[model samples]
Target: MARAHWHFPRTALAEHYLNVFDVGISSHLAFIAPRRKGKTAFILQDLAPAAQQQGYLCVYASLWGDPNAPHESIVQALEQAIDACASESKIKRMLSSKVRKAAISNEMLGRVEVEFANNPKSAGTRDLTRIDDLVTQLEKAAKDRTILLLIDEIQHLATSDDFSGLAHSLRTLLDRRQGRVKSIYTGSSRHYMHLLMSTQSSPFYHFANLHRFPDLGEDFCAFLQNKMASEYGVAVAMGSLVKAFGDLDHSPYWMQRLVERLVTEKCPLREAMNYTLELLDAAEGFEETAKTMKPVDRLVFLELADNGNPFSRALLSRIEAQTSNKGIPGTVQRALARLMEASLVSQIKKGEYHIEKPGLRRYLEKQVGSAPSR
Candidate 1:
């Protein structure tokens, strides 16, 4: 049998977010945090439930959920909400098998956002008028309850030029129903999220209040300690647990996996930590990624990870010295382009960037010295 879920509830935080929406401070909210940081869990387990209890008609979508039909993420959520208004049997029959496996209220875990939306190449073909009509229908079905839209990975819309039209349409769609529809968006890529919401030329500019999605802290560690001792009969020292969490970059996803390692393998915390790191490095493809990195790419990646200027003359000279290539602005530019294509780094602004795979840095630190591929 599967182990019972050990959720650390953030009911207070959920209420705080809901109250922000309730106060009409901003109908649109953009929350940014890295992946595996429990942002989605908080939304599904805490935020969405609280909203529903308070009479919210919650519709959640993950923009990248359907690899084949990504444009349909928002539409799909709306349709599922409509189906939810019908009889249980009818709803099951009308919706796909994915909807039935939901973990939270109407949150299609398979295509999750807790609710969220996405598209890259041609999600622009989405029908805006249909979206408007769907919202109207959901409003009627909601019986005057406010509609809360939980859109996940929303930064995907800003990653490609093709999604420009869709983004604009989505902005207009929300603008028209300012009071009726409230939205909370979560994005893992801080760079793209900034582009989507902060860039003046972007459709989403000033469209929402951007808030940093806080990471799981000591309380999360405490909760895990309680679960490990009570549920699995594994006694973990509080200091060790906190240190483990700190070592894993405070990622709840990996920390939970670490707990699983402790329970199943019946090993010490240090052994479990080592095992989890191996799993982490492998699961994130860090080893494979390292093999493909050119010396310049590695240098540029580390520079960006350190939040240092890749274009600085000093760093440019370092790259040239390390790779034996002419360390010029053009060279660094090319390296940056390659890193972006690798999906391991994000250029938040003209000359600014943030590391996408932080785990990769740790892997590289162990595998290769900072001096390029040398």
Candidate 2:
């Protein structure tokens, strides 16, 4: 129960972030990474455990878990933590089953997982005093331990103006708590995270010292290699595994799926990787997401993926010829905006972007490559 054997612990990284909190560099820390790159796993498995060991009473939740009302999710975590803290025995487990259920229930970017919740029945709203009151109660409940709130998929708060109130209230509440309540927030998009935490207009502006969640490296691959050898008796070549990890966008979840096939089928690495891509494309529903885009949107998304300037004259000319949209700039702007809203793309600064769903690039390529010449 210390740490999952399969989980390669980043104890130093975890402690480093907490040390920042301890020194008052910032009580709030925000880390952004694309989906399925092990952000959630690191927060729950590595970071939370480390904070608890440091005598912090941690309450963890994912806004994606209860998409309808993100406020409710935070309140629930606080309430759960309070209950758990009241009982010395339950405090150790720390709402493990409940928090993880939230994590697993919504794993994909915006479509299948937390993305499913973006279109809530209504705008995201939080009861200010309720969240404040819960945290206050938790402080009393936790006794000597500092209260730590770990919120995942925090970028959703920046997705709409509707969440502005919740964003404002939570930041204010945490600020008022002063070091009483410390938090670590994990987000899936740097673009949205920028809108959430970096923009001066945002309540969270300068509220949390932000960090890019580092991707799992070769050590992660080595761990997988050992796990496969020791548990599954599958001998996978090291170079092959490393290349596949890069091919899979360095995502641990997909890599693990590739490993699963190796264990059961005892198949060649290439065969397993192909199978994983097929599974990844399907799981991400890239085809279905594409069906929703405009022709220009599809073209622009792929252009960004291929590292072509979307506003280049050639691309604009192509868009005009293909879609017959005369307002080329307007059309392209809307297309990029739609892709961002769809959670298919993310902006780095102004014009630059990182594909939120990289798998979509492959899908678009197949569509283009398979098309009859126009």
TM-score of each model, in listed order: 0.84, 0.87
Report the lDDT tens digits of candidate 2 across residue range 1-374. Answer: 11245677888889999899878888889998887888877888888888888888888888876676778888888888878887656865765675456445644343455364545543233366788888888888778888888998898888776677888888888888886888889988777788888899999988888998998999889999998898878998889899999889898878878887888899999999899998888887877787787788888888888888889999999888887576478888888889888778878787787777777777777787454232
| CA-lDDT, candidates in order | 0.77, 0.80
Worst 10 residues of 1 by lDDT: 106-115
Which portions of model 2 show Cα errors greater than 4 Å?
1-4, 86-89, 98-127, 160-162, 292-299, 313-331, 372-374
Candidate 1 segments exceeding 4 Å error? 1-4, 86-126, 311-317, 327-330, 369-374
Mind giving the per-residue lDDT tens digits that candidate 1 earns over 194-308?
A: 8889899999999989989888889989998888788789999999999999889888878888998999887999999999999777666676788788888888888887888
Instruction: Tell how far residue 253 is off in model 2, in angstroms.
Output: 1.1
Global local distance difference test of model 1: 0.77
What does each candidate score in C-alpha RMSD?
4.7, 3.4
